[model samples]
Target: MDKIKVLSIFGTRPEAIKMAPVVRAMQQDDRFLPITVVTGQHREMLDQVLKIFKIVPEYDLNVMGKGQTLSTITNKVIIGLDTILENEQPNLVLVHGDTTTTFAAALSAFYHQIAIGHVEAGLRTWNKYSPFPEEMNRQMVDDLTDFYFAPTSQSAENLRKENHASEKITVTGNTAIDALKMTVQDDYQNPELNEIFDKGNKVVLVTMHRRENQGEPMQRVFRAVRKVIDQHEGVEVVFPVHLNPKIQEMAQKELGNDSRIHLIKPLDVIDFHNAIARSYFVMTDSGGVQEEAPALNKPVLVLRDTTERPEGITAGTLKLVGTEPQDVTNAMIELLENQSIYKKMASAKNPYGDGDASLKILDEIAKSIKR
Candidate 1:
């Protein structure tokens, strides 16, 4: 049997984490040749995941820059991929989730009449602008996709609801669960991590860098977290603050100088994954962590009022305790004091996947291009 060439493209940290497992699986399997491409939409953070995965992308668009708009990113990726895809025409183009890169690469491939496999597909909030471009990106990508690797039955249903073809969709679990295998190392070490554990305090891994939670909402959440940590003597917060100036300013002003709260710079994929593994629980406004935390058996208190990932909450692995200070504080308190509720959240089955999502995705790709 001849080897099938697969080009896997992604830009952000979450996309890389989920896609890494699929790429690694392909690299090991003699049946396929994997080509990885990083769009550099999220330069430093994206590179961190690639390094952790030991993946050197065959092409890098390096599209990140100051004041880059959605139009610019979409256009740049389309242009960059035009050349790459023309030269390295693969049997299949695999993209992960909803990102500018995911949509743009799929567009380029479709223009060239190449088949596309969407990993972590069928995720939807339905509201186009709720996630601000991500929702649209995934939807557009799905329209172009010949194969869909839906993470959950719910996600697969979402695709069906949108009138996507049933024959192309595969309900393969999320690949992020598979990524945990490589990232959560036994001998991971960091000075800040040590300082966190040294205080005999339970660490709450915090990450809130979303554009939606930027101004007042973010401040309110930070204030609530500070109050909660202050009230709990044996609790500490380790927040890897995002590089966004607004986030940095707010975090430094509100959470800085607090003994229990440690506001550090943005973490690389390895550091962030290891930190999540060590934490007692997680609080975040990000999408990926909501899915990732369940596998680590950690409770995630979503900072947003709503989430596209309702499956986690439905499965008892997550709680949608929105951005309201009172609600946030109450949720945190319950998790700390109520061991039964905490364990229930932690020990619930991971609805995302049992791993092996990448293999299922590959199988679908093989089926799509076969005959």
Candidate 2:
């Protein structure tokens, strides 16, 4: 039989990290011709993950522009893939998560009459605008999807609730867990984090940069964390600040010049994973980190009011504290003062995956094509 041709596309750092394992699995298998394409939606951040995972795409859209909008990204990805889809004509086009790139690529593949597979499918908050475009992006992509690689049973149920064909959905766990098996190392070291961890300081690993949480929300969150750092003697924060100019300004104004708060450049995937592994707990508005932290036996405090990854909350691995200053302050203090609560959250079972998601995704894909 001829090899199955699979075209995989992604554009942001989180999408690149989660999709890398599946792409690499397809590359190693003899039954598939795997092609990679990156839209450069988040150029520098995306490049860092690609280099870490050693994935060199066949096409680089290089579509990032100054202050790019959702429409611009959508337009660029669709137009960029038109000639490539016409040229290669892969049997399946695979996209990950809810980025504008994922939605646009799936739409383009639909336009070309090609089968589309969506990885990390069927996640929902039901509040479309809470996560801004992401909630709606994934919902729309599921409509265009021919195969749904739902990361958990909860997500699979979500797809079914929307009347997506159950036969087309597979609960493959999360590919982010698969990436952690490759990146997080026992011997990983960072000088600053090393000393902090060595001294037995309670480290709060933080990453919060969503469009809805910018400006006042971001400012208040920072202030709350800073106040917590002051209240506790050995508690310190390791915040890898996002490079957005407004965020940079807010982080500086609210979180800077603090002895206990370490505001640094964004970390690469490997460093980020290891940091999570070593930290006491995490506080973030990012989705991927919710899964990644629980895998490392670290508890998470989600900064958003709504989360599509509700499995974490149900499993006792996450707390949704939102952006209220008092709520944020109380959550931090509880984690600091309540050892039983911290231990319980830390020891809860990770509901995401067991780190073989890449292989499971590939097996389902092959079976679907053969049928």
Candidate 3:
């Protein structure tokens, strides 16, 4: 049998982090001719993860731009991958989660008449614009998908309801859990965040820069976070603020100049995962973190109104505390003051996976696709 040529394309930091494990698995396996491509949808952050995982992409679109719109990103990825797809003509194209890069790459694969696989497939909030373009991107990627490597049974079920081929959908668990195995370390320390631990402060890891939450919602949440930190002693927040100028300004306006709040530059995968491992809990609107935090047995306070990862909420590992100032304040207080509740959440079994998702995903792919 001929080795299968698998083209794995991703762009954003979240997509890169989740897909890194799968990329590494294919690189080591004999059955795959793994070709990696990046859209540079998140430029610096994307490069950070690639370096951490030691992945050198065979192709880079370098599509990130200042003030780039959804339309621009989609156009760039489709055109950029068009020539690459024509050249490689891989047996299958693999895309991860819901980014403009994911959707466009799948479309380009379909155009090339090549098979397409979606990693972390079948997540849905069903709310068209809540996650901005992400919900729609995931839905459309599945439309072009030949294989669905869903991260959970619920995610697979979501695909079933959407009428995707049942046989093509595989519940392989989330690769984010697999990544945690590689990144999170017992002795991980950075001086930027180490001082918080040295002070014996209970740490809250934060990351929020979603399109919809940029303005008022972000402000409300930031204020609520500051309030909570002010009310409690020996508690601190590690927020790796996003690079967007508006987001940085808003974050500073609300969460600035406080010793308890560490507003630092975005961390690479290793630093971020280790931070999650040592933290008391995570607070974020990031979808990947929703899966990663639970695997570390850390509770997550999802700052979004709805989550596609309902399994976490059901398992008590996540709470969807919306961005209302009072609600965010109350949720933080509850987690801080209620020991029983905290313990339950911290001890809840992570429904995401047990850190073998990358191997499962690769094995299923090899079995399904022939060269």
- Leading candidate by lDDT: 2
Evaluated against the true structure, the overall lDDT of model 1 is: 0.87
lDDT of each: 0.87, 0.95, 0.92
Ranking of all candidate structures by their lDDT, best first: 2, 3, 1
Worst 10 residues of 2 by lDDT: 192-201
Q: Which stretches of candidate 1 lie over 4 Å from their true place?
A: none
Per-residue lDDT tens digits for candidate 1, residues 1-371, read: 77889999999888888888888888998888889888999988888888878889988999998998888999999999988888998888889888888999999999999989888788888788767778888889999988888999999999999898999889998888888877788898888787786677789999998777789888889999999988989899999989888789999999999888888888887788888988999999888999889998999999887778989989898888878889989999999999999999999988888888888887877767763
lDDT of 3 by residue, 190-307 (tens): 8877877678879999999999898999999999999999989879999999999999999999999998899999988898888998899999999989998988989999999989
Candidate 1 matches the true fold with a TM-score of 0.96
Model 3 alpha-carbon miss at residue 284, Å: 0.5
- Where does candidate 2 stray beyond 4 Å? none
Number of backbone-clashing residue pairs for each candidate, in the order shown = 0, 0, 0
TM-score for all models, in order of appearance: 0.96, 0.99, 0.98
**Inter-residue clash pairs, candidate 1:** none
